[model samples]
Target chain A: MLKNVHFGPSVLPFLLVLPQIIVTLVFFIWPASQALYQSVLLEDAFGLKTEFVWFRNFEELLSDPLYWDSFKITIVFSFLVAFLSMSFALALAIFSDRVIKGSGAYRTLLIWPYAVAPVTAGALWVFMFNPTLGIVSYALSALGYEWNHQLNGGEAMALVVMASAWKQVAYNFLFFLAGLQSISKSLIEAAAIDGAGPMRRTIDIILPLLSPTTFFLLVINIVYAFFETFGVIHVVTAGGPAGATNILVYKVFSDGFVGLDLGGSAAQSVILMIIVISLTVVQFKYVEKRVAY
Target chain B: MIENRPLLTIFSHIMLILGVVVIAFPIWIMFVAASHPEIRMTQVPLPMLPGGQFFENLDIALNRGMSGMDGNGVGYMMLNSLAMAMMIAVGKIAISLLSAFAIVYFRFPFRMFFFWMIFVTLMLPVEVRILPTYEVVANLGMLDSYWGLSIPLIASATATFMFRQVFLTIPDEMLEAARIDGAGPMRFFWDILIPMSRTNIAALFVILFIYGWNQYLWPLLITSEPEMFTVVMGIKQMLEAAEQAPQWNVIMMTALLAMLPPVCVVIFMQSLFVKGLTETEK
Candidate 1:
């Protein structure tokens, strides 16, 4: 990607790149490789003895029902988050795009949640849904429904999902709005002229053109739910109600830091690395295809 | 104005208003909670409207801090967060600008290798390798320090890529003209390149500031000391403490304090934020 007629050869470039390279090596690459290495080695609880067990940690994880449960929970949680936030954002984006006036005001109102931290979002929702004094739960009780996330697994999952999804809506809305703005308006005009109603035009033309953005947002949202939502889960449920809300990332933290199962946690970390690497590859592939288009 | 569809427009406006209401509902509740006295918050059917204790609660949260936990006031934690966010945003922008400039302007050996190295950091998010990274940080004796909180998170691939893209779009004639005037590479960078990318840098700084401010888990992991706790992570401590005392008013006030800066940034610098977001994602 370098330009022609660039600067002559010198040691300046190496000096310039050194800080980033050092940080990457020490923080990112080293720890990642340590995870890989530790996944194959088992340490005793006292940190006194170590046994080199190649692949046993992974094998053990594969057979563990709890691990599988966390895996399943993560998938369900991420998809729910991605689906809920993306659909809501897409709806808002479509509406905002259609309106000719005050679109910027609508955008300003909608997008500030992107700046709200997930943990703060979690606190807000958790307060609103607290079983005893929360106004929302108080209303729910009036309607003959019990809303105790602390005791119910399903409620815990739902609470985390809502908190996580709420914070992400702004991001998805921004991208969807950008995508909508980028689409050719003449196509919508032509469709309207052909007697296609607004709904028909959106379904036939707008959604198809927005697929690339939709796909990109889907991946990004899944990634967000996967990793960035640790704070939400931590602050809201703490993976409680029988670990029903414990996703994979949380499990890695709990197992390693809390449970002291270093090998198992490292194994989980390695698996997560694989997942992220694959997701990044998919995003790049899609980006390349979009560029070609 | 493809069609004069009054009914559709009315419906669209209604739905948008509804969307805004739902999105803003929790925030409204948060504000209402923050405004009331502590005793009122614990009573049934929590006040749906604001009380006159808003500034009082802010004073308590900022000065006295939440009881039954580390007594670090909300004001102090906000300072920690501000410092961390500033360090991360500035550190990332600085390093990324240098690396991007080097890669774009110089034909150096192992340049592609370094680029890929930086790119790989994108995949290894701190969440995945939590224990090992913490171990490394602890081993380096960086725990509870600002450097520990900011340095690990500063190696950003997206920023580098964004700057690279920005530099590539600049015309080559500027560099040539500068060279003809006997300007050194660093001089050209200072006088021309950085000035040209000023808007991009500002936009990126807005996004990164939010990013650094909003960090939760890493700060929670490293900053064991009360003084080092960021407002975002400190909310967790207050939440945990609430399990015992239920200080809803003060905790809500802290949450508001934590969110205020970044929310203000996004709202005030809306266009720059949008630009940085879209460009970085690319």
Candidate 2:
């Protein structure tokens, strides 16, 4: 009977993924291969003629100051957004973990921001930071400080960072809250009985136990900062005051799609893919083993 | 002791209240600005209270300058957003449940490989091969159509992973019992798996719906015609046309309206959303 079940059940599994595999192959893998091909080909200024010019686009990108600047901006933006959001989330999770009363309401309120699409969030933030109409700008003026994202590169960069961080902190909070709930209460009690204070226990015990959650969050946050900020950046500053806020992916969008420079866009995208994939591989090799679960 | 406890509680209350204000302020500002007139929007220390321009703004937004290639109306964009979101959500749910079941229940060749493929897609950002994907769709003549919008997104690695995880939670004994009762794999899946995974399906629906609805760039690139554009793309175009000076009240009103669908889904599916997160951690 077991042998009789073999061929039929085995075939069913292939059938399950067949549609998805085909669609992905046609839409995903095929497109990616085409993009790679395009990256090596030279295109005329008007985007009509193309010639195979292997590695020329990549070399140009490597030598371009603007490309490197955008790359650096991307890295700084991703790390800052991830770090700040994670820190805030950890703090909020710890605070809300202890007090059960009204916790549901708090979680719902906190997570509401996560539900808002990033574009809407960016638009809302842009409005709020408007010099004349935005409450933030009005308050800043009242407090005797100037703030205008349109003109100041630093201010524009800060606004983009803040907008990205705001949407993400809630997601980080969700994971941290989940992690906190899973931690054995007895561990905390044992530490307390051993005369360990909350801070000490949290540092030595809680942090180690929650490392898996933190690591997962780190990956998610980094990917989000790299891939997901297109909407936020587009709406908030459009890579503002001299392209200071222009991250890598946004650059790809501008060059490939807006400027119709397919080769340059593909080259930039290849670099982005390499950076992300290498980081991910490193995480899997080194960090995955340490994940407690 | 009572004095100290009250003070601590008061402090906590203050902090919580501050959190509420910080979270709600922007949303409040959107509403407040939407209700005020254009000239009033220029007033410094912008109005603390909502005014009477809300209806007027809505009238302009819903009715004005919609004469482009795409019928310029909020309703068309709403329909596009709803249809695309629903199509993706339903399609993803169907594919995920089936694929997950096949992987979990039956012994199969390359099971681990297929599983890894799904997980690996999660690791990839969409931008990695977006250009080529665009080429494929364009070549297939799917551009400027809803099929172009829905198909590529319908098969989500995240949803597949989620469903596989969910299916693993079900006991083997249940499947064995169904088999003993002469229920075939298809029948068992339809009756048992669907009902059991209802909550998960609902959760996936909300997430995928929100994702599809919020998609801007892909749709913007693929569909150049205005009538076929999603609300998000419409909003971007609106911002682009605003150029030097934007009408804040109209912009705020439109944004607030655009936000309603996702907000409604989140509020309506609160229980499932919380449960979905809690279960994923497990």
Winning model by DockQ: 1
TM-score of chain B of each: 0.98, 0.89
The candidate that wins on lDDT is: 1
The parts of candidate 1 lying over 4 Å away from their true place are: none
DockQ for every model, please: 0.89, 0.43
Stretches of candidate 2 off by over 4 Å are: A1-12, A46-49, A194-205, A282-293, B1-9, B63-71, B107-116, B277-282
Q: How far is A187's C-alpha from truth in model 1 (Å)? A: 0.9
The numbered model that scores best in TM-score is 1
Query: Which ten residues in a row are the worst by lDDT in model 1 chain B?
Result: B65-74
**Per-residue lDDT for B150-191 in model 1, tens only?**
999999999999999999999999899999999998998899
TM-scores of chain A in all candidate models: 0.99, 0.92
What DockQ does predicted model 1 obtain?
Answer: 0.89
Instruction: Compute each candidate's TM-score over C-alphas.
Output: 0.99, 0.91
Tens-digit lDDT string for candidate 1 (A1-293): 99886999999999999999999999999999999999999999899999999999999999999999999999999999999999999999999988878888999999999999999999999999999999999999999999999999999999999999999999999999999999888999999989999899989999999999999999999999999999999999998889999999999999988999999999999999999999999999999988765
lDDT of 2 by residue, A16-128 (tens): 87766666667665666677788899989976789999999999999999999998898899999999889888877776776647878877787777767778788888878
